[model samples]
Target: MVRIKRWLLAALVMSAGVSGFMLTKGTSHAATTDPQTFISTLKSPVTTVANQYKLYPSVMMAQAALESAWGTSTLTTTANNYFGIKGSYNGASVTMKTAEYDSNGQLYYTNANFRKYPSAKASMTDNAKLLRNGTSYNTSIYSGTWRENAATYADAANALTGTYATAPTYGSSLISIIKQYGLNTLLDASASDSSSSNSNSGSTPKPKPVVYSKATYYGASGTQTARLSGQYATYRLYNHVKGTRANITKTAWSKVAAGKNVLVYLDMRGVKKDASTGKKTTWYRIRFAKNTSAKKYWVYTKALTLPTVKYTSGTAAVKVNNTVSGSYYDHVFNSPYLAKSMGALNKLTAKSYVADKQAIKTQDGYKSTWYRIKVGKQAYWIAATETAAAPQYDAVTYSAASGTKKLSAKYSKYTLYNHVKKTHFNQKTYKWPAGSKKGTKVTVNFKGVKTAYKTTWYRIQFNGSQTNYWVDARALA
Candidate 1:
């Protein structure tokens, strides 16, 4: 089942092409050279999605690039579904579908559940939300620093449980795309950096344009083309960061459009200088925003610290189980538990409960209890809720007294009602036996011929004790 699920998930990602793979150095350059037309049409909407959802712009862009090959996939073309999202949308969705597999090793075609949009931009915007909130894949990998132990986006993609085998190199492929285009540059690390700042009273530095295209300078404004504007005391642009000079005299807007999507380098107070290079720098990296209004630029407050290298020697058999202290139930209650009835529990004398096909003695005394029980190397109990009792079999106010019939000793009669499965039927409302009470409402929907069966009859199911049991099921139909 696990293997089949993994394959299905891989198919969804790979079928979409680029989005399935991780961004790494090997595949980045090849995948990133998507057409400019695709970029222009999709880029703006992608940025809008990032800003609205507070997600990293580059990650969104990278996923789109990977999924659609810059709007080239059949899924995207027909359904506007760049992510190959499954079909069965509760609201508006595309009718397009593709063949996939289930965990049972059966193949089926399902309409990919996708939110259809008027344009590729709208699709990009919706895709961001799906990525951030979707349960199938984890969005953490795209947002934060990758951790060693926890599963990230790449791991989640691989862990997916549907047809995803088409994209064999999905994780590595996406990573390659990110590195090639420097797409990870869209995340803002400024907030994390600011946490370590020594200055409490200083104002946060406004960002310098990272990719300014044109500029205007006049009257009271000072301009520098290649470097920092003279208006500010100190300003420096890092990699992927751009600066533009603009004039306030003519009331003209800054000419540096900077390619619409830009990563800005903001100022950080209390930055120190490298004595040898005479360069004033802080631990800063460039992050792109989806649009002009986006909270685009990010500057780190702390200096970049590199971790010390480590080395590992040979051979050792380490203990895999790290269970320090906990009861057996705590370890495996949610997983590997089986459903067993109280009658089956008592009859088992083996090391644990035997698998299906093993016959056991039936005890009428303990029938009300059904347990999600594990009886193997270790026996554990779960889902131990008591089963409800049968309804009363006596005269009632709302009686269906049409054609009453007698039943065989093993046969039970039941009336068809919405709450017939309920254990305690109201004796005042429905016809039932005189001695019946709340504890006798247990009856499985018996499969048999309707004409031969009684419309309503008494069914006695097990309770913990004999006296507590009562006649249950509907009176008559």
Candidate 2:
């Protein structure tokens, strides 16, 4: 009888070992298989949760990735708590001490309650259920892509404050993740977020034409012609890059076909090149008065395919007018560049001199106003309304000179209609160095308003120049 009992015990032990080995193998396979499998499995459940809450799947995925470490976290494995959710879960709970830091930079330890469940799937379902009922987890106002990278999702899983702080590069990181992992593909209708398929026909407005108000020509050699006409005539602007157009939209630039020239508008905005691929895009999004939605059109330089226009000092020119009409020959400005003395150009700093307002497509919009000028330079079509009389200056000297001593401070601020320069002061603050001879003529030229401040306090940028700051009229002695 004793021998029989020993044999039965050995058989039971062998069975236990085999079961352990099988469990380990199964776990290893589940961990190593494509993460997308897990993503797919959770899609339906995630979609159900999002639809009930009207949340974006991208946002939900971000939150999940941040809390659960893509289902690999210790909390998920041990407790089946994907969200690190703190609270009592029926009678099944765990009490633990965790460190926390306050905004004032003080750290303290606190014991809190955590929920324990049977599996990750169960944890996820319960988390959704709790979020639906919990007043604190109110998912209504909480929605946005987490990070641009998959690894960031892991870090985000640990975030206690539903949202990661507004750290620099948050948007870029999330966007990069979406692009790399094709997470946006999960946004398809069949995926977790059904709203992706909802068609709101009335909400979308009709597409509008992109208006270009000005154009300039770069000669082979060198000569800047300030254009007077043909700002929006659609003659041609060259593409800065070569690639297949992917996200091109109206006014948005796209790659031109190989060996073919593309004419794009020179909408004035800084261009951006993709960090990974060299594809380029424009920045202008100004809109016209008629079509309010026209503002959505963004102009870029990379969409066009043409001989690149080399803008040299003398070759770069501009023109301003009432409106952008049909395609016509560019009547380029031939007059010499204008220059202004300190007395004329000094105060012209407050106003913004736009080189091209045509990119905005607004009716009667003007191109950038001239802020740089040289003396004795003459240009045609100088808008009479835009020009301001040269500032009158009263000379100041230590010794009695034959000139008037009254300062120009009392006169109304004057501005230049065209680009002007200062042959004198460099810094915004110019004064007589101590112990110098009194005959040194110190004249303060009146540049126009610094900025357009409305209330009792005034803070203005230079209207025609680059200087923008606070200037006290009383301090202008």
Best candidate (score: lDDT) = 1
Candidate 2 stretches with Cα past 4 Å from truth are: 1-34, 102-111, 118-122, 125-175, 191-477
lDDT tens digits, residue span 1-477, model 2: 000100111111112122211112222211212346546655665666654543344545544554454555444444555566766566676665555556455866666566766554555556555433434533321122122211232232222122332233443454554455566566423442233345465232222222112322221102211221223323222232211121121221222211223222222334455433454544332222223332323333323221212111221222222232211112122212111122322333332232211111111233322222222343222221233312212222211122212223431232212222221112133232343232322333333332323211112233243443332333222
Model 2: number of clashes?
A: 53
Model 1's TM-score against the true structure:
0.30
Task: Provide the global lDDT of candidate 1 against the true structure.
Answer: 0.34
What lDDT does candidate 2 reach at residue 364?
Answer: 26
Candidate 1, superposed: residue stretches over 4 Å from native: 1-37, 87-91, 104-113, 134-169, 186-477
Maximum-TM-score candidate: 1
Per-candidate TM-scores read 0.30, 0.29
Tens digit per residue, CA lDDT, model 1, 1-477: 011112223224334334422322321221223444444455566666664665545555666666665655555555565555554333656554556677555988765444444455556655555544544443332222121211233333332212232344555665665566655443323322342363475554333222223322111101100112223112222332221211101111132223222323222122334322344533332223333333322122221221121122211111111122212221112111111222332333333221111111112222222122244454333222221111122232223222222323332343323222222222112333454444333343222122333433332332332221223333312
lDDT of each: 0.34, 0.33
lDDT (Cα, 0-100) at 214 in candidate 1 = 34
Residue 113 in candidate 2, Cα distance off native in Å: 2.3
Clash number by candidate, in order: 56, 53
